[model samples]
Target: MRLLIADDHALILDMLQNFLEQEKDMEIVAANDMQDAISAVSAQPGFDLALLDYDMPGMDKLDGLRRFMENNSAPPVVILSGHAARDVAQRAVSMGARGFLPKSMPAQSLLHAIRFMALGEKYVPVDFLFSSDQADASPAPDGPSATALTARELDVLKALCDGKTNKEIARDLGLREPTIKLHVKTLYRRLGASNRTQAVMIARSWGIY
Candidate 1:
């Protein structure tokens, strides 16, 4: 896989580059800031993925992600941050970021997340997605907010967003298929959505993905 990773911190760039390059068939290029990242994309032109630091120079919060998406026929973009809030991560996903990766996350998980996003799956850590400080998240949902949804319901919502079938979600969550069905029913009612697509759309609007 080809990747473009940009951050202002040299140590982070080195660490990521060195670690990721150790895997076979992985090619990585690094840039120091958002402008440099854009320039690198312009020069290279067809990276498979791009990891952008959330607060680097020229990254006026999510404006940089918006600009990057607008500027290039870009690959999937994931935000890399050390301390971005839950609401910020949710907004990033809402703005079309493939995922958000906390700097403190385990490197193995980071690799998995990168691959997951590269494969067209959306990603955000569960804790980050369901954090306590969600003041910036979308206005409270009409039917049920995150507070009203159980953790298992949240998992079902995310699986729906992933386009997983009830059986598939059941297997992944280690629940019986009938139990998964029950969760789906609850998710639909609580999300005020009548169908899977509608439920996913509502969830995305609430930053659930």
Candidate 2:
């Protein structure tokens, strides 16, 4: 995959470029800011994916995103930020972004999200899509707040809601089947459930589904 990574922070740029290029099929072109990213696209014009720092210089929030997406030659884009609120992520998708991702996401998840969104599938963070109701995992007085779940656990729970098998979820999230089993176990413990059906039931009752 050819990637264009744009961030004002040189450290972030280096970090992403170094990590992504470790994949033999991946190549990266780094840019410091929005304008630089636009210029890079003009020069190469064929990046398989572009991950843009949502608050980087010249982004002007979503305006820069709008401009970038309007470009006919632009590759698929996903917004990455230290603080992307639910509304903003929703709005970015409404404005044609493939997804909104958090910078703090585990590197492996980010890689999976990068590939998932690049394939023209939307990859919004599960929490972002449900935060209005579960920001604190707020639920009935007797139940665990879905908020008690980690983002990755929420991801696993959501996959369960979709009725996907452990292997399928593992493949979707770029994790091993054993790691997925571990996540399922963690989800069961966190949600106080013993099986996938009960887990999904509890999650849905809490508005996590």
Best by lDDT: 1
Candidates' lDDT values, in order?
A: 0.82, 0.80
Q: Superposing every Cα of model 1 onto the true structure, what RMSD results?
A: 9.5
lDDT of each residue in 1-209, candidate 1, tens digit only: 99999999999999999999998988999999988988888888889899999989999999999999986557789999988888788789899998899999889878876775665556776545554555555444344477667576788889999999999998998877866776676567556789999999888887769
Q: Give the per-residue lDDT digits (tens) of candidate 2, residues 51-125.
A: 889989989999999888877779988888887667778788888888888888889878777776665566675
User: What TM-score against the true fold does each predicted structure earn?
Assistant: 0.66, 0.67
Stretches off by above 4 angstroms in model 2 are 131-209
What lDDT is reached at residue 33 by model 1? 91
Minimum summed lDDT over a 10-residue window in model 1 is located at 135-144
Q: How well does candidate 2 match the true structure in TM-score terms? A: 0.67
RMSD of 2: 6.6
